[model samples]
Target: MTEPAPELVRGELTRELARAAVAARTGVLRVTGEPGGDLHVVHGLVVTVDSPGAPGVRALLARPGRTSTGVADLRVVAMMAAVDGCFAMASGWIGGCHWQDAPEAAGRPEEAMPPVPGVEPGWLLLETERRLGALAHGRVSPHRNHLLLTERGRAMLSGPGSGSRREILLWANGRRSCRDISMLLCRSLYAVTVEVVRMLDDDLLAIAPVTPDPPIPEPVRGIGRSLLPRRRRGASGINDTLPPRPPQPARGQRTLTPRRTERTT
Candidate 1:
């Protein structure tokens, strides 16, 4: 008889990743959930993380009118992408995950970028947890909440600006979320989220209320009319329907008469 394949214990994502790292596993852990992504593990170390919720190395390097082809630049961008992607995956809901053996390829083919140094799972988890705690304390969500610039934000833009703050201020028009701005600017999601939260604290930004989707109308029952039964004739040739009558006050209740309206016509 053939033996069953060893099943990976299902539990928290952090625990599973730690287990894989300890075992020195070389494979891809495909996590499934909202904004899910894959973690490329090499000899128990996480080299890269790919998630739709955050921009990747290529996107980070593909800034408008700017190009970087140096190996050093690539490594820096890859490191940022890995950390940001891990945060993106952990911040949201994770349904489940499964590991797949990939002995041949080091990373995804579509990446087309050279591999950088591998990051330890413990360090990655620690960094991600730190970021998560900071974001939670700031009451900001990179994926869900939309932001808008306040009067102070516009004023701040008029002064000498540095980093991505000016660009973020311009983009927060009560329509785009932090994730949207991150993709548009090709910046790290964690960085963008942190900046947005800071701006919010400085009274430079405000959270925009998300417009709820319109409720779906329920399907009408039956074909034409309602499915309710119609009035029927009684055995005495009278309709079963009762005649409309004015409401009467209950016993011991004061019955106040309604005021009559005077017609001018």
Candidate 2:
């Protein structure tokens, strides 16, 4: 047979597969009981591999640490890993190619089974990190499939609790964008944005300008000046073109004093 593709032979794709699978188990990262450790949010999904598809995917995960494992036999090892509580679940792609996790798979009969979260750690995930440390180096994936998290990954989502003011403060740190902060905090796009704004008003977060504020509109300034009536010209000579107003009117009362002749608008 002709030489296998570089990715296939060198296990580049398998490496990606393992990395992703590891992420599915570890990406959401829930380390409960630790200081500053809480499940903030998760992007990982539960996966179900079809007979052939899942077998291939599973095999990739189990390839290493096997003495007599071949490509076909890799799935068997993966099953063992899951059976032994290594993998959270063996995924099944329902449709449209989305690998839905088991927990998220509820209520949706169509579309791929959603990716599921895993709190417990797994050997494959550990191996993946050791072997594919490069993959986890950057920010978590923005795309659906690319962001898969393992059991440990799901735990990373534990942050400030639901509707907690602290959660908003976490997202609004340094005026981080909702999208970026959401990724960091493992929350959804909408949750971060609304919560961040709420915290901002509370002074728990700062309103940061992405760019310099645009120059103040001259007309607006002029309108502000015209809000007061033009002072009648008088000997008071305060460049008056506006009415002279008395200081501190009674509550809910308005006092319109005659404009000094010197006053100009």
Candidate 3:
């Protein structure tokens, strides 16, 4: 059977993944962009997704107290990671993609946890689109905008809330964005973004004003190397060789008296 070309357009990445899934192709689809990543497909399902923009299942499971060893738990975590990874890519700039065929064994050892059931690319794309809609509704950019806690939020944190909310509040110091908080807490970027939006609606969080970068200092010119014209150096220069004028007589004397010279016979 003829295979589709490996190269993919930026916005068509998700659709191509869906096509690959429907075709039951097995391989790695490497996406390229600002924060691109790999989508490992087994048969037609996406086994796993790896993107720098979002934390992976390994990091999520590796948290201090997340010690679930059941097959069900692993599957849930893997699926969450996969969905979050897709969302991360879709939210950013996707330049293009390339696919390469490989045996399933090639990706096995790289798994942070045991194998879990794969997710359908079509469903994954839909879910990612839904997330994008939610972000749009909230008027928030998870990757671009920084967040900070309001006065009320600070007080609420002192009272009671979910641990996740508290961690987010603690990290929201007018510097970190939703993505930043997500990576720091090993939580899903979508989740963090939604939570941040809710907090904003509740007046508990505010978008931090982006501080403009400091202006670059102009280069300093050396003393004698100024751009203005240099003074002329040699003879024939009008001012260069002029003799000093004699001091004028005191205010009352208008003219100098001539000195009498005695002629010798």
Candidate 4:
């Protein structure tokens, strides 16, 4: 019989475990997820983040010669790598993976790993969130799902803009969506979309719909009003404001005629 599938771990729950490990100041935390990589944290500091898809800590941080190799340097690099890994994990670059708190899972590699300074687990989580936000603010758009450049958007590219603004303006052509622009320009869709939206807000791009307004509804007619039931007012379920009247006689029937008043002598 096939063994049961490993429980897929969510990024949020894994972060929580990291927080706990940081608080305890003793446990090791392992987080495995897609795009496909693993992160090992010991005593609230990250040791290694191995993901082939993304640049490792060494690539992110400039390496100094043998003279500069110190405990502080190692720790800083390790911490940076951890942050990078966290971003990747949170972004779901890696496929769904599992996590465990066992000592074996947290074991340091046989090779000398970069030394990481003691950092708070909560702090790391907070930093990751902040970076994610910054990443979003630069590329992602909250209001727009699609990107379509206007005539003005095209003109701005050759006009007076500088740097990234010029690049985005040049790339926008009313046909590509934000994701398309992202891939074309080697930038994040979130970042590209934000700029596009800014341009749109500035009237530099136009994407409003051109359909005509809906027709006004006709007024309610007497027939519509007649369908409603008439309401009576009173605690006893009858209109009480008007005085009660004697019941009318049935059709073709007459009520007892009042006796002829006897002439009172």
Candidate 5:
């Protein structure tokens, strides 16, 4: 059997896991205590958790490979890393403990931070890109960030790279798929998918079901023929033509008639 197309694989995975990390993070992020620090009890494990402070959630992705978050806003930042893969857990201060030290009971109840093969300095960041791609309703395939967008997205579009911000609004008049947008801006579909899904995550975009392929209308003379058996050229066959309904009277067919009232002296 042929393997599913990459885009199809992405779409299906998106359908299945789009909420996996978010759900996981939501469970953990919410359990955290104040940034000063509190205990987060998850799946029955006791974790000394701290919420982010100061500049807020934006600081979460600013520094990846975190052990302490090392800055402010460690709680939300840690959750952000959990959802995106291990970007913040790769190194540095926050990366060391928060990410790497998964409660010994953490992940079999397995291990929390397992080794990833062929991982580089940027692997988790890249996987974060893929997770974003998995959030789209449209077909999306994975790719890199050498310049994932003519502009970057949540990763850069609204983060530390905001100085170079650009508009991401797509025109309603233009008929282009996410893939087309990716090509136009010199990005990969997965990258664009990240932007679109983030927009969705933030209520910036909402997706409506799309017609992947146009439907074929019934044939002129063979409509509904499959439901019935084929007839000989001269033999009678099932009549499948639908009759047109009579039109209703146009509006204003009846005009309003004002009634006169008699006044008593």
Candidate 6:
């Protein structure tokens, strides 16, 4: 039997994921490109993801080689790690991806690849759009040192289940810039920058001025007010009716009027 070569199609990670989601395929997405990674999906739900430069469950867990316990803890850690890994993997150009039957486990430690916290395909798509939006605005310099929280942002934080959005709000603090926030959060600078930019686009965040501006002097304000003259309050001052005209003389003769005013006792 003649063996067939693996099909290689070049596109974006989001595109491939969209196709898989629409078809409701249960398979492993093997990606190789600028930032390579593997994502496992069952019936269009993302189960796990592995990517370089992103911390997985093993790296996140406190006990790497200790007693195996706490299935619930493992599940939570796995979920966070998987989402982070997927974010890292989906970023940048995607060379190609190969889809195949879903595997029992990925090529990582069982603890790190727990089968919990499956993400909806639609959610993944939304996340990808957010990251791309952030990237478009990531041109912001690393030295930026100011951010202001909007009313909408405050409202969002006040609510529950904002997830990374809440974390970003907490770190923003109106005093730290994107770079500073990233350092404080101990996450990727690019990741933090993306969030910052997206918030800015959505009007949820604003760049704070480095130095507080001086208040306008009271004298200056008064001067400004004085520049404008007050408007007249009464009706039209000019008389609409004209006084009676002096009697006209002949064409060749001249006419004179008395200058003194008439006095009455």
Number of clashing pairs per prediction, in order: 0, 71, 0, 14, 14, 0
| Stretches > 4 Å off in candidate 3 | 1-11, 67-69, 101-114, 160-163, 217-265
Residue range 146-167, candidate 3, lDDT tens digits: 8988999999788867566788
lDDT of 3 at 105: 51
Residue range 1-265, candidate 4, lDDT tens digits: 0111112233554555566575654344444544456555555455566553344655545432323457676666667666655554554433444555535434656433334554555566666566555544333332233455567666666677566777666655555555455445544333555576677767666554435689999987777757887765565645556778879999999779878877877
Candidate 1: give the clashing pairs.
none
* lDDT (Cα atoms) of all candidates against the true structure: 0.79, 0.34, 0.79, 0.53, 0.34, 0.63
Candidate 6: give the clashing pairs. Answer: none
Let me know the TM-score candidate 3 reaches against the reference structure.
0.72
Q: Which stretches of candidate 2 lie over 4 Å from their true place?
A: 1-163, 211-265
lDDT of 6 at 54: 58
User: How does model 1 fare in lDDT?
Assistant: 0.79
* Candidate 2 structure quality by residue, lDDT tens digits, 55-112: 2233435333446546445545433333222111111111111222334434546543
Give candidate 5's TM-score: 0.24
Better of 1 and 3 by TM-score: 3
lDDT of 6: 0.63
RMSD of 6: 19.9
Ranking by TM-score: 3, 1, 6, 4, 5, 2
Worst 10 residues of 6 by lDDT: 1-10
In the range 193-213, model 5's lDDT, one tens digit per residue, is: 566545445544333334469
- Predicted structure 5: lDDT: 0.34
Ten residues in a row with the worst lDDT in model 5?
Answer: 87-96
Pitting candidate 3 against candidate 4, the one with the higher lDDT is: 3
Worst 10 residues of 1 by lDDT: 1-10
Per-residue alpha-carbon lDDT of candidate 1 for residues 47-72, written as tens digits (9 for 90 to 100): 88999999998898897876787988
TM-score of each: 0.71, 0.20, 0.72, 0.39, 0.24, 0.42
